[model samples]
Target: MKRCAALCAGVGMLAVLAGCSGTPEETPVASSPSTIGTTSAPAPAASVPPAGPLGSAAYQAELTKLEQSLAGPLRTLTRVRTAEGLTEAMTTLADSLDAASSQLADLTVTRRLTAVHEVLQDSLGSAAETLSNSDRTEANARCGGVAYTSQKVQRQLRADLSGATVPLDRLGLKFGGTLPDPGPEPKPVRPSNGAIVIRSGPTGTGRLKITNGTANDVAVSIVTDGKPPAKPHVMMYIQAGKAATISRIGGAYHIYFKSGADWSPTRRQFGEDCSFQKFEQAFGRNESWQVNLEPTLGGNAKTTEVEAY
Candidate 1:
């Protein structure tokens, strides 16, 4: 009995050992041959289409609409105020671009749509660039016009103020001169025939003389280089043969010959005589001077001469 029990215990131990030693059933680990050396499929790549022409028919239509909207306000601004009109036009353009951007933002990403997407992007970009450039140009032009007009008006006002002259009647009262008989009828002032002589001095001084050869008193105006004479430096006036000296008023050297007057010596008077003296002084002694004679209706004389001084 003891031997049999010992043998039985040994047998139990052997069975446990065999159970532990048996190959694990591998849990039937189902391995796939496909997974052995295969890689996972790659995620789809984003597609980019090639850009197309910027001025396609569709793009041209949109461009036309934008241009027309801009043109009206631009034209109006050109004729009147520019700032407000330009601003309004720019706002409209921005709104249009915003709408376009919204449309572009909603585009669905797809490989097949890549080409269309690229074309749209290029067209939008080109349009935006063009509009921006146009806006800058228009704004600059408007600002320049405003500045130019402001300067012109200011200059004209200053000139009118500086050239203001006291009426002859007021001056007579100050001088205690009896009012000349209310003249029955003064003859119409007429321009006299004369030759304009321009001379240059060694010291860089320019001299102008007008000699009257005709009999009728003439009203005459002298223009230099097609520009009206400036006051206080260059001056224009009629003179009789009496040795009267006419002077430079502003930028003009002028002497008017009375119908019966011969040549006269005129003193140079600036400021009071001419308003544009500062501009005229730019022509130095060695420079050329242009003289234009304008008569009431029918006579016009134009001549140019360089100073010999």
Candidate 2:
């Protein structure tokens, strides 16, 4: 009876094991452990949209930015005092303008603004070429006067910018008022080599003879040696390699002089390459005073550069 009971129990355990190992189609199969909690696949990355063409306002704003970038460099170029300095400044300006033209070329503009953009780019390129190809000798000659050189460059830049005026105005864009005008050129003086202009002070028997041996024309002024320094008593224009004498009686006074090119009689100064200087020594009353404008080795008189009046 005990053996039959043990055999029946073993058969019952085998039947339960067969039921757990049923066929794939009849069984409810479980997911793998790795994918137990997963619900769906990962999403794809988002893409950026393409930029559209610039409108009128946007195009104008871009042009204004370019102009602002160039203004400072142009002003700096005008302030350079020497020929080499002017050349360097002009090259820098040309480089800046060329870069600006390239930037404009890269911009995408609407159909209406396309023509305007081309005009601006062409103007900038042309101006840059003009400056880069300027004659060095001409640039040096212009360097004689800061004011004269400044005026010339200002006009040139203005003319170049003005080439786009018609197109810019047609589009109702801002133009023509960007660059500041440097003013008109002064009239040239046509006085003789020994012209004299007596300004002020009482007449006297004193004589002043000026010998101008330098390359530039010179104007000499004899001023009273007062507590605050009085106005010049007598003025004379002596051309280069010439001499002039002013005869009159006057008290002790100091001598001041200016030299340069393109003398403007109305303004009483040179239009370019100007310099002002004064003798350190003072001449006494009723005497003959002689001076050589050019500096000489072992000279007795001392001169100092002074500010313009």
Quick one: best TM-score, which candidate? 2
Query: Per-residue lDDT for 1-309 in model 2, tens only?
Result: 001111011211110001000001221122112111111211111122114376666666766776777777777776777656677777777777777666665666666666666777778778777777776424333424445555666678778878786778777776545565777655566579878855676887777767786888888888877723225788888889888887774777788887777776655666556777787766667766556676564444667778654
Q: What TM-score would every model get versus the actual structure? A: 0.23, 0.56
> How displaced is residue 56 in candidate 2, in Å?
9.3
lDDT of 1 by residue, 222-243 (tens): 3343342322233334443311
RMSD of 1: 46.7
Query: What CA root-mean-square deviation does each model show from the true structure?
Result: 46.7, 39.6
Residue 115 accuracy (lDDT) in model 2: 65
> Alpha carbon lDDT of residue 7, candidate 2?
9
Deviation of model 1 at 179, angstroms:
73
